[model samples]
Target chain A: MDEFSFIDSIKPDSYRQSSLIKGIDDDAAVFRQNTQDIVTAVDTMVDGIHFSRETMEPYSIGYRALAANLSDLAAMGAEPAFFMVSIVIPSDWAEQELQEVYRGMASLGDGYRMDMIGGDTVSGKEFAISITVFGYVERNKARYRTAALPGDILFVTGTLGDSRAGLECINKKIDNEYLIQRHCQPSPRITFAEQLSSFNRVALNDVSDGIASEGSEIAEASCVDLHIAYDSIPYHSSIAELFPNQYQEWILSGGEDFELLGTISEREWPEVQQKAEELNLSVTKIGYVSEARESKGLVYLTMDGRTERLEKSGYTHLQEGRD
Target chain B: MDEFSFIDSIKPDSYRQSSLIKGIDDDAAVFRQNTQDIVTAVDTMVDGIHFSRETMEPYSIGYRALAANLSDLAAMGAEPAFFMVSIVIPSDWAEQELQEVYRGMASLGDGYRMDMIGGDTVSGKEFAISITVFGYVERNKARYRTAALPGDILFVTGTLGDSRAGLECINKKIDNEYLIQRHCQPSPRITFAEQLSSFNRVALNDVSDGIASEGSEIAEASCVDLHIAYDSIPYHSSIAELFPNQYQEWILSGGEDFELLGTISEREWPEVQQKAEELNLSVTKIGYVSEARESKGLVYLTMDGRTERLEKSGYTHLQEGRD
Candidate 1:
């Protein structure tokens, strides 16, 4: 079969039963979400760079590609509407493996109610997956990172360093089931993150690279200093016990934990709690903020009964600063 | 450097200008195009599959990866906006070569005013690049393959099969300039293709995978027959001499031509001609559609003035279809 026919064959049919002039053909696939804000984001995942080349499964590749992108949509407090994916892999890759990746992605898409609109498949010198997610938020209702005020309380969803520590533990052949699961699939706190309502002047972001890195970014972007309480910071007990010397650093800097770090007003703290309980999400208040100038607009915190200057933690793609 | 650190080291400072509410550190990045009509597509390119690993430059790889995806956006009649690129390659690839690749992409992006939003970089078993493009067209100007109806005239933009023929000539070391140039950098017809208005119904699609295969798809999806007069087809003189025995077949089925095939009404024919001449675009009438029948569909008029059946003519990634 020709490549065109192959695309035509594998391309998923649109289940959308609305005014869709084109599903997948032409210069683009058109989607009309009447009177709705068009939310969009793009994510690309590389092979060994993002995942373990030694033992990672192809299905995990598909899942992570879509999950990582979808998590972006969630970070914006937007509902994922639709997405398109592009895949490039070696010519000799097993056809079944490709399908497995698609199946994993489609499963996540199903969970998020985001339709897989269309994508392209090609043979490349390496494996690369790119996903573009389209989502929607009410007019001006979407969240941002610059909204954190001086007194606002900072909180992160679920646990931190689990995924990062998981990778390390798994590498060492440690018999820790919880850590392994975290490394395998870190839950995206989409539901909890999106429930953050407007009017709270809430600043929102997800922790992928690491908590301290993302915290400082939000702080720097907002021109505020993140005042963290190390004791209040959440983590997996297994990680703490296994790597005592590195626990604090890993918890602060270890990346790839797809959790949410949001700031809400002190007045709305109770509401945040109520909403979390209502949504069945764990809302942990781990820190607060002070003057940007007081700390050079960086992350500082109280740890072990001392006012310790918290070093920037997390993966820094750049040489100078954290992500 | 660790694989993760390598990805980190390659981070560009312009990422801060992504205008994404929360980026890089989060599960996803978010942006709103503020346009109501959303159009999207994705394309992937593999190494040693789409290009010669030995002869092809890294910059060419980046340029073509983007050009191919942008061509898809153009075919949809959507204004090119933003794109996401994902690349997975062997870790041994020189850092400078990767820089050249990005430089080429950034140059194209600068010319097109398209943003390099986000993507993944991983070390893979093979080299692969996946790009997903998000664009928007005016609601009143949305075009689709299903929009084509009876009485519509099929049209093709530019000449066809030059890319394939050019590649063949290069592989054979044909002592020709045109063939090698065409193979190296086949220009995508982005500007002139939009002359075909959107108010007009079109079974329009790009000749990316090949005219025959894409044409067949337009016919198949629209549930109509594509009747092509082989003599009406346009071609480069070099291609005509390169594949003498199967020149027509190659043009019809050859992939990567990046020309466009679409249908327009007889009433719009005058305007199309005026615009084509204005834009210096070659607008060739290949065939017209006939009534849907039980068995008579996808017809081709031979050069000897004989009618014959046409098959899907394009490249497939399967090993058997490879050169």
Candidate 2:
């Protein structure tokens, strides 16, 4: 099918929302937010680099692409309202496969109450999808990485490194379904973020590029230093069971966890913990933020009781050597 | 350079705008507008299909991608504020070339006073960029393709078929700077659109997919028949000078002109013409919307007074059959 026909065929039933003044079939999508500030994010996933037909299904590809953008919104404590998806498909792919991709996107959009507003479909030599999500946040209350203050207690929601472990399993053809699922369909911590933001969290970011990388970002942005306790970091049980020797490396540098990494005041730590327990979310307090020392960068206190400089190691596009 | 460093390097100097609450460092960009509704549009351009390195420079590729999205916002009469760009670059591209691509984007963004707030960069087999633009329009004043009325006078800003003709010149290695420039950097009609919206134009769309395709879209969406005068449509002088025989085909079916195609009330025509003249914008009256005739689709009235059915033929993704 051509671009127009394919778009027509998958024309989603107008899932109307009060904020959506206009949806598809227009030059641009129109939306309104009475008093809240708007939060917008865009993320792109490419075929071979981000995902591959060899390791991922079309549905997962679509789901994860949107999930990445949604994770960004989640970090901002925004309620996703609409998303636009632009896809470039290789000619060899069947229309059924493309439909499967949309099906996956629709399923996720339904869960988030996000309407598919507008996008473009084009042909390319490789398969790729770029999703832009629009959401709304309470005025002046949206979290930012630069908001972390000295003496703030840092916490992370849910376990990290599962996605990286899952990727390893896929590459090695391991038979762990949990790890595989984690790798394929990592969840974005939207509900947890929303609850945390209600308490005026200090700073927040999603664990997309590993804890070490994300922690460094928060510290750098806020002109502070993060002291993380290696032993205090949370990880999935499978990490210790299957990759015992490499678990620490994975926990520190494994990317794509999509969990919320944030900081809060020491006084509010108990209340934040209680709220997480109420929401049935696993919240781990792993570090603290402090004024930067004279000559040191991010500090990692290892299990061996030794302090070391934290290196910025994670999944970066050019560094992957995948030319 | 890795994605992080590259993004950091090009961090645009803080072009402070009152509406922008947060810029590139945040998880998602935040902005505010008191009463105006938000408008968003996304467009993607890919290697080979959209433009090849052999025929176009990286700057043009990036400029055209943003221009396409800006054109959509222009059609809605939105004042461009921010745009997020996500790019996938093949590994073979030098870092300088990638920077040139961003230079192109920054040039266009500067012209429109649009900020590049947030985006993602990744690796891919082919180079591609997707841009999502955010703008605002006065409440209930945004134009829509569905708003065209039966007696509304159809009009288009600037000349059509120039982009297509330019493509032909490039393909044939003809040294015509005007045609080539038209194809590479067709300006979006933002100022004209804003002026027309102030006058409450009936309906509007950009001429991205030729006059016939865009006209038929407005007609079908509004459930009215558009009677277009074939010879009355405006064209570039280069089309007549070079491809006289094919000029009609280019005018009717050639795509990517990026001119605003709109309609206005007959009573508003004289004032609209005056406004266009004051703005130094060339607008041509092409046709008028009419009550739909039974079992007949969009109609084309030729110069010889012969009526013909208008076929939906412009640029379509898969129809081009480029693998």
Candidate 3:
């Protein structure tokens, strides 16, 4: 099919919002302005770099691609509203394969009531999917990396290192369905993040690049020091049992976890923990924000009574062995 | 440098709008809401498919990419606001070369007061740039393809087929500065489109896919027939002189002209014509809309007193002979 035909085929059967004035088949999509602030982020995934055909089906590739952007919106405590996807299709991909990719995105987007508005489709040598997601947050309430204050309690949602373990299982050809699922279908913390919006101030970052890098970003942006107890980091039990020696690296440097890492005032920690329990979501306090000393914006990890700088060791796709 | 550092390097020196709350170094960019409606569109350009590095320098590639998106906003009759760019960089692209791409985009965006907000940069096998641009229009004033009436006057801004002729010149290694510049930097009709928004209602589409294809879209969407007098279609004199025989195809089927193809009411045409003259813009009346007969919605072209169907023969990248 041609580009226009492909766009027509992938348009949602019905748009969810009345605010969406125009959708596909237009030069641009229009949305009626509301009182809420707008939050947006874009992410692109390419074949053999972000995912391979052997490691990921087209459906998972599409699902994970949208998931990455959703995770970013979640970090800002925004409600998912709309998205635009630009895909570069290689000659090898079939019509059914591309349909499955859109199906994957729709499946994830349906729960959040996000609508696919408009985007571009073009032919290329290799497959690539670039998605731009738009969400809404209350005025001046969107979370930011620069909001972390000294003496705040730093916390993370869910367990870490599971996605890396899942990738390892795939590469090693191990039979671990849970880990594989974690790697393929990451749930964005939209529900939990929406709850956190009630607080007056909070600093948030998504753990797409692992907590080490994310913590450093919050520290650097907020100009505060982050001190974490490495022992307090949570991991799925299977990760520790399957790869004990490498689990630490996976927890510290492995990326694509899609979990929220944030800091809230110490006084509000109890209420936030109670809300997490009510939502049945795991909220772990692994660290705290402190005043920066000579190293103004640094992250420190305390392990076995020894504290050292927590360098940025997050996973850099295609950079591991090539560099 | 890593992806993060590269993103840091390209952050705009300053954002133009106070409504832009958070820009780079954040999970997502946040924008304070205003009363105007928001319009957005995305376009992706892949290496060797859309434009080869041999023909398009890094700067032109970046500038043209943003131009393509800005043209979409102009078609919607919206004022440019903010944009996000997601790029996939191959290993061969140096940091300086990639920075030039951003500089090219910024140079054009500065004219319209557009700002670079947030986007993704990842490693890939082929270089690609995907940009999502957002603009604002007065409430209920954004143009649409379905707004054309049967008695409207079909029109186009500036000249057509120059960009395609420029591409031909590049491929043939011909020396024509004007044609080459046309291919490298075809300006969007943003200023004219903003003026058009003052009118009550008008149907609009950008001539990215040639006038035939763009006209057909308006005809099809508005459920009217477009009858064009071939003699009246505008083209740069250089195109007619250089490619005497192929000039018709360049005007009819060649793409990437970035001009505006629209229809305004017959009663409003004279006033609109006066406004175009005030701005020194060439607004040509090539045809008029008529009630669809048996064909429901179709485009017809009259040449030498003979009328025939104007089929969709617009250019499709990478589809010329590979099929």
Which candidate's DockQ is highest?
A: 3
Please list the residue runs of candidate 1 whose C-alpha ends up more than 4 Å from where it truly belongs after superposition: A1-21, A25-27, A52-59, A89-94, A124-126, A168-177, A242-246, A294-296, A306-323, B1-36, B94-96, B172-178, B242-246, B295-301, B313-323
Report clash pairs, candidate 2. none
- Residue-level lDDT of model 2, residues B49-92, one tens digit each, is 88888889888888888888889999998999998988988889
C-alpha root-mean-square deviation, candidate 1: 4.8
Give the per-residue lDDT of model 3 (tens digit) for A60-117: 9889999999999999999999999999999888888999899999999999999999
lDDT of 3: 0.89
Query: Judged by DockQ relative to the true structure, which candidate is superior, 1 or 2?
Result: 2
True contacts kept of each: 0.73, 0.91, 0.92
Off by over 4 Å in 2: A295-297, A314-323, B295-297, B314-323
TM-score of model 2's chain A, to 2 decimals? 0.94
The model with the greatest TM-score is: 3
Model 1: residue B91 alpha-carbon error in angstroms:
3.5
Global lDDT scores for all candidate models: 0.70, 0.84, 0.89
